[model samples]
Target: MAMMPRMELRQGQSLVMTPQLLQAIKLLQLSHLELQNFVEGELERNPLLERDDAADVPPHANGGDGPLAADADSFARAESLNSQDGMETRLGTALDNVFQGEQPTVARLDTHGADSLPVIGGAYGGSGGSFEEGPEGFESSLTAEASLHDHLGAQLDLAITDLAERIIGQHLIDAVDDSGYLGEPVGEIAERLGITSARVERVLAVIQGFDPSGVAARDVCECLSIQLRDRNRFDPAMQALVSNLHLVAKRDFAALKRICGVDDEDIADMVAEIRRLDPKPGRAFGGSTAETVVPDVFIRAAPDGSWLVDLNPDTLPRVLINQTYHARVSRAARNDVEKAFIAECLQTANWLTRSLEQRARTILKVASEIVRQQDGFFAHGVEHLRPLNLKTVADAIGMHESTVSRVTSNKYLTCSRGVFEMKYFFSAAIAATGYGEAHSAEAVRFRIKQMIDDEKPAEVLSDDAIVSKLKDGGIDIARRTVAKYRESLRIPSSMERRREKVAMAAGGR
Candidate 1:
């Protein structure tokens, strides 16, 4: 059929993404630090917004004065709106209406639990040095320490007099890595620099004699031998032991003892001495401190025998609306442009205040539901964490799945068990045989970890053995599933655990 163009009218409704609505959605997903930065930016741009410092005032004189009180009023409005039949729907509608005629203004805004090996303490006066009281109070070593390259460069400049040799020495030093081992071979470096391999080796040997003692060695054996020679301990037996370092790493104490030609007592003493040597000599030079996580919500047990969910007051950014200033600006506005500016600021300020309050409430709500569903987890431990999903929480709280997901993303809740990501409560179901309830995958992982943690070195549990134990506990998980969970918890394989245990046992000897 041929169609002709004609004028027609149709009526329909759709959800529009207003700026305020988008802001609210964005606010819900931000972590505590991120939300703090966003609110600080808003406070800088909007003259009507200020932080509510009333909570900080002493009780006797806690009464707030001036426009800061508007925050409480905004909170009241939020509560009243929240009490409506369809609170979220009504809240969105009100925000949309307020920002309806607002023209967008250009605002210039300037923008892992890893099971790490225990960091061995650095050598004397290295990264792990203790602070001493200076002429002032205790002085901190905040300044970045000299890098490996810088340290070697200084030594090269002082020790080498010839310009050409100094250049080669610098190139050789550049080849050294943070672990104090040469990344490139001396011959390769010589070829690249159009120099003799013997000259490069001579310079590298000198550089290895620097303060770190093993900074320019090409391999672990050479690195350890350099340190040992410097300390007058690199005897023939020590040389043989250094050459067969891999056997030492595998904890083959018998093999090591034979190769070093030492009895059990002497080899044990040698092994203990080797443990004191720095494997990554340059690592002590420059490293940053780890960033710590601050939990967003705090869950404590109430006197009524239930979980009490509250926003961490320390993390929650206190904000207020300067109504007195806003009213004054509105009265003094001389033209449409000025009035619009004031109106936009007021709306933005009010929306942000309400949105912040709503963000807190949503976090509390989601945390409460989580605590309710996994109340056993809070009461007991991780083993009792039930199988949970976003849809289950959304259904219980009468919210969308995506909203629940946002509330849990990048947010953490702290309880008696310790701080955990909100996502920690949501785990896939692990099937159970017979008439028993399914187990949370997380709980299963924790159980697997517990088994591994308790396993004696002599009787380290293999994946198959772990599967049998889990089945005995009523969790119908496969051997592969046990292996997967074990890896996820950063637990090494049974073979690796056995090696580690062997090493510990040998060290004790």
Candidate 2:
């Protein structure tokens, strides 16, 4: 064959990933907060995109059944019901009647066993007020907490008098980490400041004695020692225990007893006292605020024993393209450059709105299928969680495994049991004995935890024993697999557990 410059036209098929399609895929995997941020950025950048405030508009004004209207209807009905004589008795009777019906409606039970009124709309169904409505209120107005550095600076200003000593103290405070451990060595600080090591040590000692007792200590053991010295309880036995934290971590109570030169009761007392001390003193002062996990989907038990899945409307980004604005701008454009800019903005805005809508629908579809597949889990508990995987869900919903994986990522579902990440429903399958059905790895882990929790101090279950118990229950799992699961659950080995139980018994006595 000779190499030649030639143009050959061939017909073929390929899936082209357009920019809009890529954007949709990217939006699918983002958590609610991330999606909100992305949308907010788009709103600022694009001229034709605006937030959908239709939710806040009254239903009567919009001439549609919106959230506000539904909420008003529900409140009206509640008031009317309340106005009747013997309303409390009638309400209880009405609930009883509703509970006996075959149709499933969203209902909850109070501590008194009476059926709580169903929530009317927004995420589940109908028109109702959204959780996103109203001002952020007092929480938004509250100031950020003082950082660890600021807190220490305030204390340092009050405690130190001399200029040279105050400068050293501030430098030492700067070296202290968020965990309240001194990051720099005394020799290093001394060398850096052209000061004597002894002077640095003295200043550090005074600063350590400042509020948050152990703020300037070098290590965990030193931190504990500082707190103990402040309490005037740094006795020899307690000192020994603090020095040998590795043994404490291993639950080697017998070794602790020997090292501390104390009886079981005294060692236990010292351990308890150490536990009462603040380990991360600086965390209480200036750690970053924990971000709340807002679930994208909700799973509720219907009255008919089926799980009802709904997308959180509050989490769903509501965006609309300003078609009127786009039309007006396009008409005002005099040149191709101006016309192109207007058209591009309109296209981008349209894609974003469609992407958001598709993202919500896909999330709802995936979540609903998950609830259907793991119906046993929601009905019962973790023990009943079916063996599931991304492929299983993908195949069931007629989507690719990668698409399913992306949908599940960073998304959470709120249910009666608790809020769990969407990925939690999918676990590797564990084989079963004989001709029995496969078990979920998660369900197996739950079983092992239950067996260990129920085990008496006198009868601690080993890995082999757990394997035997699971085998008897029709789950064909290995001892090593059980051990892996046990370790993953942060459970100690049988020996460690037995030692802890024995220590607890001795301490109680």
User: How do all models score by TM-score?
Assistant: 0.66, 0.76
Whole-model Cα lDDT of every candidate shown, in order: 0.74, 0.77
Query: What is the Cα-based lDDT of residue 159 in candidate 1?
Result: 93
lDDT of 1 at 40: 70
List, residue by residue over 1-509, the lDDT tens digit for candidate 1: 99999998999998887777877988889987787678677777889887665343212322333211222234345445545622321136633332233221111111011111222222111112333567554335455667777787888889986655666777777777778888888887777666579987888878989989877888888888888988899999989888888777777778988888889999878987888898788897863345578787767775545555656665667777778888888899999999998888887887887676676667766776777788788888988889999999988867789989998999987878798999989999999978799999988998888888899979999999999988998999988888888887888788878999977885688
List of clashing residue pairs for candidate 2? 67-128
**Backbone clash numbers for all candidates listed:** 0, 1
Where does the lowest 10-residue lDDT sum fall in candidate 1?
Answer: 105-114
Best by TM-score: 2
Query: Cα deviation of 169 in candidate 1 (Å)?
Result: 13
Residue ranges of candidate 2 with Cα displaced over 4 Å: 1-7, 54-149, 159-207, 216-218, 232-237, 261-269, 283-286
